[model samples]
Target: MVSQTSHVYRYRVDAEDTIVAVDEWWLAFAKENNSLDLDEASVVGKSLWSFIADHATQKLYKEIHRFVRVTGNPITVPFRCDSPTLRRYMQLTITRHDKQHLDYESVLLRAVPSRRLALLDPIQQRSAAFLTMCSFCKRSLIEPSGWLEIENIAIKLRLYREQTVPEIRYTVCPDCEDHFGSNRQKLESSSEQPPR
Candidate 1:
């Protein structure tokens, strides 16, 4: 039998690596129920999921999502689906925000590195993926690598909405074009320098 302290230690290590925050209520519940049995790890594992489903507050659920995103690791547990088994288990639940309330009906349970739902159309995705720019002209150019012109392209590109392109015209203000041209020259010169 796994001692309660041992179980908690193991759980803390595992959860720390993946989950961002641990729920105090859930931790207390586990400690009280003596669900820390290694021999009956399977039962305890399933019970944990049930406990979360029944008792998890909205804040706790949101914390779990934040944890997964920051850590990039999946939650695990100790149960098998088909026959009945014991090892260790992982469980996760995600809720989407509705206009006024959280929609829990679409909860999902799986390993980590979960996929974010697609919020942009195909054109938007493609444009976002490939669009670059000419600093002088402010033209959006589809390039093989990624967006150019910006010092930190990936970070800056994230600021723009995929569906909305910045207004760049032939009649752009002369001063703005001059500023862009200077930036372009700097970037070009930097690229020409050999790696340090």
Candidate 2:
């Protein structure tokens, strides 16, 4: 078990959603994760959308941002930011900074050591086959078995016997879409004024 450090990384963006500033914690986390390209110097001034790989996840974020802006309320959502050997659970809170700006704070909630799958290893060799992964839950789509966590998928598919792991392609799983989608709709309806 990885002890909870409660590490928080924060960044701010303008109305156009371009990253304006990132805190030192953000930089430190990126370095610790071996994500050099995510360093402050490279990430600052870039569109947030540039970092998101898939459209479904991007759309979910867009809706969350819009909800915060319109309702002037902060929303916290759970997500996974996993490393090859660790499953990192995190919570992201989006708060309105002003009418046209927002602040995003991500806190590490929990982390657990798990058997590593080459599929999650950035440096691992990849096969031609592609695996569709849920961006929010870190689950992979296994046909006939539906969406499954990486550990189960690895065993079910017997990836250990393969020379190379399948490449990961990210998307939103139906469960996540339904959960967030319903909440978004509720927020939208509540924020609407009835009959002026």
What is the C-alpha local distance difference test score of each model?
A: 0.30, 0.83
lDDT score for candidate 2 against the true structure: 0.83
Off by over 4 Å in 2: 1-4, 160-163, 190-196
- Find the candidate with the highest TM-score and give its number: 2
What is the per-residue lDDT of model 1 for residues 96-185, given as tens digits with 9 covering 90 to 100? Answer: 232222211111122222122121122223422333333222333334543343323424455234444333222222443444454344
TM-score attained by model 2: 0.89
For all predicted structures, in order, the TM-scores are 0.18, 0.89
Per-residue lDDT over 66-150 for candidate 2, one digit per residue giving the tens place of the 0 to 100 score = 7787777788888898887788899899999987789999998888888776677666789898999998898899888899987
CA shift of 138, model 2, Å: 0.8
